[model samples]
Target chain A: AQTVTQSQPEMSVQEAETVTLSCTYDTSESDYYLFWYKQPPSRQMILVIRQEAYKQQNATENRFSVNFQKAAKSFSLKISDSQLGDAAMYFCALVVGGSRLTFGEGTQLTVNP
Target chain B: SAVISQKPSRDICQRGTSLTIQCQVDSQVTMMFWYRQQPGQSLTLIATANQGSEATYESGFVIDKFPISRPNLTFSTLTVSNMSPEDSSIYLCSVEAGGGETQYFGPGTRLLVL
Candidate 1:
């Protein structure tokens, strides 16, 4: 069985600052994928970024980036130059091949101005 | 990512009433899925719908409870039958648009069974 854990329940960061959300998982599969999704109050889930296990390079999309440590089984999301729009519930998910996705409890982020 | 939309964004229905949520995508997609997200919880896969075939349901979910319909590649629907308070949750339909392992989601239908 695979499990994803997000130790931080809530996180806050000043506007234009940086914030890192921690995520860890336990999976036996060597080849897998990690993803970060964001859901705002509107209840729409948006894909933030994704990292492939085989690739050592981290995935970055403008302000969003991921630090994927395959050895430690850790995939953390870093939001640089955070803005108010970045405030939302972030979820860390792991998937192997085309199987079901195991998601974490989620971390609620607040961007303070 | 494909443009997706769901009907009846939010609904409050009486107990024992069934609600059907529709999911429509802008382009033809090969794989479509339905997920349920309870209050303060993560999303769980309910079933996977493919064109011209029966939907594959996940464990803990049954076809009787969540009857799914996938008539084509661009649209799907999920019906929550014999609803109860426990069934009240946000139902979202996602599509494997970009292919690979990524899935894009709909806005989700918020159901509150009274």
Candidate 2:
């Protein structure tokens, strides 16, 4: 079974600063995908970024980037220039082709202004 | 991008009653998933609904307790039967988009059983 683990339960970042949330997974499959989802108070889960296992380069979307280390099974989300709107619960998820997605415990991010 | 909408965004149902939540997607999708998010907890997969087939439930979930229906490629419904306090959680519907692994989630339906 594939499992995702998020070590940080809570994190805070000052406005205009950056914060990184750690995530690790256990998967034997050589091909997979990683994603970061942000759930705001509205309870709408939004896709933050995505990374493909075969890609060596990290994925970047605006201020959101992922440091994906496939060998170590580590996929961390980096939020740069944090803004107040970034406050939410962030979840790391893993997906194998045509299979259900496994999600991390999630990290509650607070943007301190 | 696919846009999804869930009916009865939030509801307060009494125990022993069943509440059916509807999920509608703007575009057809091959895979649709239902998830439950307990208070202060991460999302847990309840079942996977595919068109023209019975829903595949995950471990610890069953059809009697949470019956699901996928009538078409772009519509599905999940019913919480015999609701209890434990069933009071946010139920979400998600669909695969762009033929990639990424999933787009709908605005969840919050159920509060009393």
Give me the candidate number with maximum TM-score.
2
Tens-digit lDDT string for candidate 2 (B22-70): 9999999989999999999999999999999999999999999999999
Off by over 4 Å in 1: none
Cα TM-score per model: 0.97, 0.99
TM-score of predicted structure 1:
0.97
CAPRI-style class, candidate 1: high
Residue B90 Cα positional deviation in candidate 1, in Å, after optimal superposition? 0.5
Tens digits of per-residue lDDT, candidate 2, A2-92, equal: 9999999999999999999999999999999999999999999999999999999999999999999999999999999999999999999
User: In candidate 1, what are the lDDT values of residues A1-113, reduced to their tens digit?
Assistant: 89999999999999999999999999999999899999999989999998889999999999999999999999999999999999999999988987878899999999999
lDDT of 1 by residue, B1-20 (tens): 89999998999999998999
Model 2, residue B30: displacement in angstroms? 1.1
* TM-score (chain A only) for the predictions, listed in order: 0.98, 0.99
| Strongest candidate by lDDT | 2
